[model samples]
Target: MTAPGRIGIDMVPFTRVRALLGGGLLAGRMLSADERRLLLDGDEPDVPGIAGRLAAKEAVFKLFHATGETVPWQGIEILRAESGAPWVRLSGRAAALARGAGIGSVSVSITHDEPCAVAVALTAPDSEERSAP
Candidate 1:
């Protein structure tokens, strides 16, 4: 049987992230390789994008936490589809935890305006095979 969906939301300020990015290494530490590439390839002043992704990651983390799971910062990767839609991919401890929790997939939505960014994540059950009656 499918369980009720769980949602998590997070918001962050670009100014805070911009200050953290000033350290240079913080971005590499927080973002995956592909995410870094995308950020670099984008237009200048990527603070909003960075903040949005950070919020996305936080939202996913909160979702897992709500389900009594603790995933590492790098264990959850947020990537954009070719169409520019945000999505979540889990790996390492995060993936193992999700599997144990019966979480099949997660959907993410991200939005940003000058000073702030926000993200929402929704968790759903994996589709299960049914037997013929």
Candidate 2:
């Protein structure tokens, strides 16, 4: 079982996100379809939004605590709630890594200021871990 209170945080600059969007490749590689729709469907470039999502993804990846594995960038989805709050959904390698790490759920918070976006992720113990005999 893993220890309690596992947390991860990351920060991303809006300028970097803008550069990635301008490059076009990293944006496609990093963002999920739904995220793309919400962030990229707009007329103007959503630099802060993209930066927040990137920060969120990096933050989520840190929770896995796995070494020698590449971060499954697109496999970590950051979705918005009806209230416009951000949430996390993991798939593929990200989900498997979380399971192996004894993580059940991850809660994320994102905020953006003038130049950068910041995100923090907190993990809950897995059901099996909590219920283990």
Name the top TM-score candidate.
Answer: 2
Give a tens-digit lDDT track for model 2, residues 56-126: 99999999898899979899989888778887888899989998987888888999997999999888655
Candidate 1, which ten residues in sequence have the lowest lDDT sum? 124-133
**Can you write out model 1's per-residue Cα lDDT over 1-118, one digit (the tens) per residue?**
3335778899999888878878875456777787778685666647888888889888877766545454466777787776778777787887776566566777789999987999
Runs in model 1 with CA error above 4 Å? 1-3, 42-45, 66-71, 128-133
Q: What TM-score fits each model?
A: 0.82, 0.90
lDDT of each: 0.74, 0.85
Least accurate 10 contiguous residues by lDDT in model 2: 124-133
Q: What is the Cα-based lDDT of residue 48 in candidate 2?
A: 89
lDDT of 1: 0.74
RMSD of 1: 5.4
Model 2: pairs clashing at backbone N, Cα or C within 3 Å: none
